[model samples]
Target: MKLLKLVPDHTNIDFVRLRGWAFGLTLLLSVLAVGVTFARGLNLGVDFVGGLMIEERFASPPDLTRVREVVDAQGLGEAQLQTFGDPRVLTIRLPTQDGADEGATNAAVKKVSAALTQAFPGATFTRYSTVSGKVSNELIRNGVLAVVLAILGIGLFAIFRFEWQFGVSTIVAIVHDLLMTLGFFALTQFDFDLNIVAAVLTIIGYSINDKIVIDDRIRENMRRYRKMDMREIINLSVNETLPRTVMTSVTILLALFALLFLGGHVLRGFTAAMILGIVVGTYSSIYVSSSLLISLGLRAEPGEKKPARVDLSNAERIAPRER
Candidate 1:
């Protein structure tokens, strides 16, 4: 039986030739992401905005129209409602009340629960939780800090293992992936919650791994082919590794798409992040990483040492013949 190959080995595609175009595209996308994030801002979830969560199991799935009416009567702006694990179980995320006082949050919950009881007396509370403004703010701060630390940690590790240029290139590619992920959420007005942050961090890991694999191959090739030009070596390395990259990305995309389509609302944002991450991550690995490597003036790695510069004064001078 013949084995199938996504990209046959020894294919001589010139990935380096597209570096300029890729760099421009990445720059444009990054700029747009930053702009959107600042101007429109992320639709931060209750985890970062303080809200009440109520999960109740009804004797049967109550009339959603009636339930919506009852909740809206409380004037809580708009609450997010969806079925939990089972259809009989409903999960409701309440909007943050203007007042942060215990009384305000408590009263809001009381009003909501009372309405539920009147509408469906058999309804039983499965879970009730509250997130305060202070706690929410803290969570936001920590979430952001976590991303920054992750990036820094990954960068430092790459630099130590490979070279400074390789490390910097990886970092840049990861950042591009991150900004694109965030931009998608911002553009779609998706809930930017703890789950989404988790997904983004996961993407960082996935993207960096792909980039490192290619970078490692490049380094190895540098050692193997001492006379090869930088562009030629990069092109060779990427082409050689293309099969693995495609296989890994395709596998991940399949899983993520499954989660996106089959998983319920709870996993929607998380899955969306993963899907976008996989795509952007793969793109960065193929283009951004290598491009950044070249742009950083890394014609060679530290391990690929060259001959030391000759001392002109100590070097022998040749006599001119038959002037």
Candidate 2:
């Protein structure tokens, strides 16, 4: 189960104070990023923009300039050319006009195919898909709904599992991770699409798990160390769990890096998003979530009644005599 065997033991840094500084900076940066995303908007892929997607196979790899010339000869709005699975497979993306008729669209496709055939004899092309604007709109709406639902689900789960403070802190961390990821996409202008949505959702789940793990430890420490200060207890919990957090992140990063480099163009965007998410998720779990807990005035001392037990089965247990 231990993927990393050389992780350093607990450090005695003042995590609560460090958490505050980190969260404040992250919040300010996030607000600015969100503003930019709202103003500039995401660079949505062909999936969200009704377009003609053609996959062509050539005896020899097609020339990019020639492909562009052929598609432009068809008078399509604009054509994007990229290699797909291999050098021989070319992907052509063409955006349909705002009010073009089906006849116009088909004619454009025919013109491009004819020109490409004339230029590169023996090359074969296939119509991968032609999505409509209406479908793309529906997809955009559904993707937003899914993200909202995921956040709500996480909040509800946190409430049931721990307390309102834990729920609030965890939700804030999730939102932070999401906004930062979106900011990265907007700033870099990545081909944000359905696959990116899947990546974001995966990040949400992964980030929340990290927060929950830390919160679980904090809750346990709160019960055990009744006399400790809130800051001390939070710090203790974070320090104790830091090794596991780091190891998990490293393992996820390695897998994502492999996908980024070796998985080809189809998985490039997906893996890039995942890589960014893992880094942001880990950072927010440690700094943003923990800091938010303190900001919400969560105290280590139990209020009125004892809190519910948080399972510590995986954590190292110290015997009474050892303690």
Candidate 3:
């Protein structure tokens, strides 16, 4: 009758010692992700680049070329027809001119819709979404601001609750997780839509929460084990919290996996992002957050430091001893 041990209470893995390799690899991949982002850029979805999105369900798998034929006949301009999860569903995307007015774009979309209806009488549109060029630009700006402000907000909260080093380390690890997620998207050319932006923000929040959990444990250990080496203290705290981390991450991953498989293509990107965020977030909480302590000169004790006092009263009261 032995209980299962996810992480033994006395676990003594030298997590701090492996920081260099972990940090280096994460940094390398993050840098590469940025490089790729700048080079090829994200596969901008309609929300960011301005286009028409139509999700249609058919009696059966409609002919892709026939669908394209209808869109081209209507002169929708650069229409792409892709199959959604099952062959019974289709997603048609049409990119508009750079400065086309919204009404004009909508007219073109309507024409395509009409043509599609006539071409495949059995096809039915389940969703119709539109984004203007101006709106898309604004969305891009706002999305970036949201992510930055979220990080800044978390950093400020960490600073008020913990040391400045903890705040900085938390932000760094969060940025690492963000970069890794973005890198995965960039490399895979996944559709970077408003939904995905939401996912990234969610990831940031999730990642920071994980880091805070570990940081809380570290802060407690800093006071509890004041005489131990800082590295050892970090190792001890992480090991102590390892079980919680594993349990939380595994639970989150289970839900995300369920969504990834059962939620269909509509939620694929967002679910995949959550999946990636959890793993990187957990790693950063353990390695990146603790490693920064050494780099930022926060390895000292966490207790309050007393200011030096001159005791000027000793000179005035000089008769008691050899003074």
Candidate 4:
């Protein structure tokens, strides 16, 4: 099915003005989100802080408040309990006690395990574990490397397919999306973990595809509208591609919404990040990437002659000679 219909030929739309407003809004939101992140730190997940993760499955959905109280009662450092997978599944995260020996960590886990079993009888428990400090450091390093490599790869691809300017603008838009996603995590204090890193990478790949589509249209316009002004051509290109952008974004959002609401906790963080990225990525494609291209001196068409202004003074100056 055709998801988008082309605007009739000879239609006029003010792309520059539309892009300007979109860019302004993105800039405002990005700045505000950054400020919020800095003011209130992100809630780093177990992957960042050294800790233990426990997963338990009950015959029925366990009571979250009761589980939290039981775990807290054990004094096994600070623990967080939430449902995962099915409603019957529960995951607990707890910080390792300060200067605690191996025995202490084990003891804490055992105490919490015992308490959970008592609080919810006949529940089956499984302990899946990791060291928080190590996980956190590893995740941070890997995430940084992944983003850097993605940018570099995109830059090279852009340079190869189009121009350095295209590569640069594409990378900027990708970073824009990444930072915006991070800002969301920080603002909400959502658990930033390995899965989230995966989500960010997924977003980066997706956002770049959108950027490339718009960039391709701009390049095509350069060849087709040989006499148009740069601003006018860009506006035209954006308008031509606007329908596809909206359609793709909407379809992706629909899928993400389903995952966000129904995929359970195992997929919640991933879905949440994807949903946020979809919105930001769509805006960045039109506003951030395109505007950055204009800002970077993208020319409309090469060798197009400028029409000289009708100079009445020059005509007057030569009138006596002509007479």
Provide backbone clash counts, one per model.
0, 0, 0, 6
Task: Tell me how candidate 3 scores on lDDT.
Answer: 0.79
Cα RMSD to native, each candidate?
Answer: 10.2, 5.6, 10.3, 9.5
TM-score of 1: 0.78
Which is the better candidate, 1 or 2, if ranked by lDDT?
1
Q: Distance from true position, residue 221, model 3, in Å?
A: 1.2
**Superior by TM-score: candidate 3 or candidate 4:** 3
Off by over 4 Å in 3: 1-5, 58-66, 81-88, 96-110, 117-122, 302-323
Expressed as tens digits, the lDDT of each residue in 174-268 for candidate 3 is 89888888888887776789999899898888888778877887787667556556776677667767777888889899999999999987898
Question: Model 1: runs farther than 4 Å from truth?
Answer: 53-72, 75-110, 113-129, 301-323
lDDT score of residue 115 within candidate 3: 76
Candidate 4 to native Cα RMSD, angstroms = 9.5
Question: Model 2 over residues 28-132: C-alpha lDDT tens digits?
Answer: 979987997998888777678878777777789878997888778776768888763468877788886545577766776677777788889887866656668
Residue 195 displacement (Å), model 4: 0.8
* Model 1 lDDT, residue 75, Cα: 91
- lDDT of the structure predicted as candidate 1: 0.80
Give residue 14's lDDT in candidate 1 (0 to 100).
64
In Å, residue 239's CA in model 3 sits off its true spot by 0.5
